[model samples]
Structures are given as structure tokens and as C-alpha cells.
Target: MDAGAAVLTALCGAESFSAAMATRPWARSPHFFVHYVPVENHQTVLTSPAHTALSTKLSTELPTDSSLESLGVQKLGMVVPKRHARRAVTRVLLRRQIRAAMAQHRCELLPGIWVVRLRAPVDRQAFVSASSESLRIAVKAEVATLLGDVLRRCRSTRHAAQAHAQPAFQQPSTVLSAP
Candidate 1:
């Protein structure tokens, strides 16, 4: 199923921000699903007793660098319920919406690990209060724009490197044969 339609499966199963911080290569962009994994406790969060329980299960379900090779896109999934409704059902729906949004633009997006972190609460009541279809669309557009920006940066860097390396010269005219 497309990631968008497969919202339930995708959001619930995405790799956590903390996990990606430890195991994946990350680039900062304004469009991120931020969390509060402290710099000091990062190691403990990944290895702590309670976190470990979730990690072990997550390791199997979440995509690693090698696994993403098949999809040609990198993605991270996480559900962060707002402190008020941290464990609510509305959070799941938000995640699902995100997945759906990601799936819709999967083609234009770059192939690399993309993290989908959820910061809003998913409690039914919470979602009812704050969720909207447009919010999901806006987030998706922002993410895609961010990814595009990254791609542009990479291209520009490579171009700069190439420009520095090349010797200045103009190509000679080529002879053409007409049949």
C-alpha cells in the first residue's frame, strides 16, 4: 500500500527521533519532528531498560540504512503524544495522516532516510480539538520543500567542487557527417 493510505502501519511503526539521532545521518532543517532527547542522556535513552524494550521491538520493525535501499527513500517514524494527551488515539491518526502525505509525494522526494516524528497528542479529544486535513498537507509540503532544499544544496556543493577542479577551456567544434 502507498505510505499515505498505509497510515496506520507507517506512523505506528516509524523509527523514533532518538533512534535516528544515534544510528542515522541527520541534517538540520526547520521542518523536523523535534523531540527532547537531551544531549547528556542520549546514550541512556537508547539503552535504558524501558527504552530498550521498545528499541528491541523497533529494531525489527523500523528500517535501517540497509533496508531503505529497496525503497530508495529514507524515512523515520515516531509518535509523540503531547504531554496532555501523550497516549491518545488521536496521535495515531496524526501519524497516519503524515504517512499518507509522505506517500503522496514519494516520487519527487529524494531517496534517503526521512524521519516522521509526531509531536502532537493523538488522543481522540485532542485530535478533535487540533487536527485538520490541511495541517497534514502543510506539513507534507514543508517536508518536501525541505528535502528539495537539501538536494539543491548537495548539487550546488558538487558543482562548486567540479568548478574548482576543472581547467578553463572551450570545446572545439565537432565535424558532422550527413547521410
Candidate 2:
């Protein structure tokens, strides 16, 4: 897959971050949870120069269309709380795993702002070291599952919204001719 196609904006700024947090979460597991909110206009929400650079790069690689324009760009944010992973190394490792797993499912995800927040710590007894390969593998699996659930939920929600937006029935027009 093209790097540009897989690239995702990292959500910044307090307003956008808070907005993502306020949205209902799509999935949750022992270690992490996901929150996402659809963005109607990427330009308005993504004001940073980095976002512009990424958008231009993506646009050049992909064909332009109304759907593509409306889809715009997808943004991601990660929150590895210290309470969940006390060691900085562990937090960094988890963050990297989250990014990689999300990248794999980028195509399935709708254009929106998504945030993955760490909720619990991995048991130390399971893996002796923070850098243990086993721990990395476990983290990757968990992240993949979390993202998969979120994507499923997103699709269902979108379908529901579309169903509601369509008119149930149309009224027939009545005409009277001169008697």
C-alpha cells in the first residue's frame, strides 16, 4: 500500500481533542478503548500545516471525487495514560502498537477523528520485561481487535443514520381540472 494512502493526521489542539473525547466510544477492551467522531469539513477542523501537507500528498496520489472530497482526511489520537503503564518504555511500545494496528485497518475506517485511550496495564507477570517480544505480540493483537470492533460499530451507526435520513414516503400531488 502507498505510504501516502495510509498516512493519518495526528489530532492536535485542545478543541478537537476534547470534541473527540466527548463522542461516544465505539469499542472497549481491558487495555484500551476507542472514540470517533465524523468530521464534516476537514479544512475547518484540521488547521495545522502538517495536515495540509498530508492532504496535498494524499490528493496527488488518489483520484479526486465528491466522495473523496467529503471524506477528506482521517485523524488519529492516542492516550497512553501513565496510570495504565507506569514505565515510559511500556507506554511508548503500546502507542507504537496502536499506530501500527490502526494503519492496517485504515482503509476500513471512515473519515473521522479517532482516539485510542489506554485503560489498563498489562500484567508484569505475563512478560518479564517491557520490551519482551511476547508483550509486543499481545499488544498488537489487542489493538487489532479493538480497531476491528470500532470499525464494525462505525459501519452500523452510519447505516442507521442513512436509513433515518431518507424520507419514509412521498405525498402524491393532487390536481383539479375545470368542470
User: Which pairs in model 2 have colliding backbones?
Assistant: none
lDDT of 1 by residue, 123-166 (tens): 44423445567545655566566555545654675578689999
Q: TM per model?
A: 0.41, 0.69
Tell me the deviation in Å of residue 69 in model 2: 10
Q: What lDDT would each prediction earn against the true structure?
A: 0.46, 0.74
Off by over 4 Å in 1: 1-19, 22-71, 82-87, 119-170, 173-179
Candidate 2 global lDDT: 0.74
Tens-place lDDT digits, model 2, residues 17-121: 666777777899888878877766444444434445536465545433232454546778998888878778888999899888887777667777888988787
Say which candidate scores most in TM-score. 2
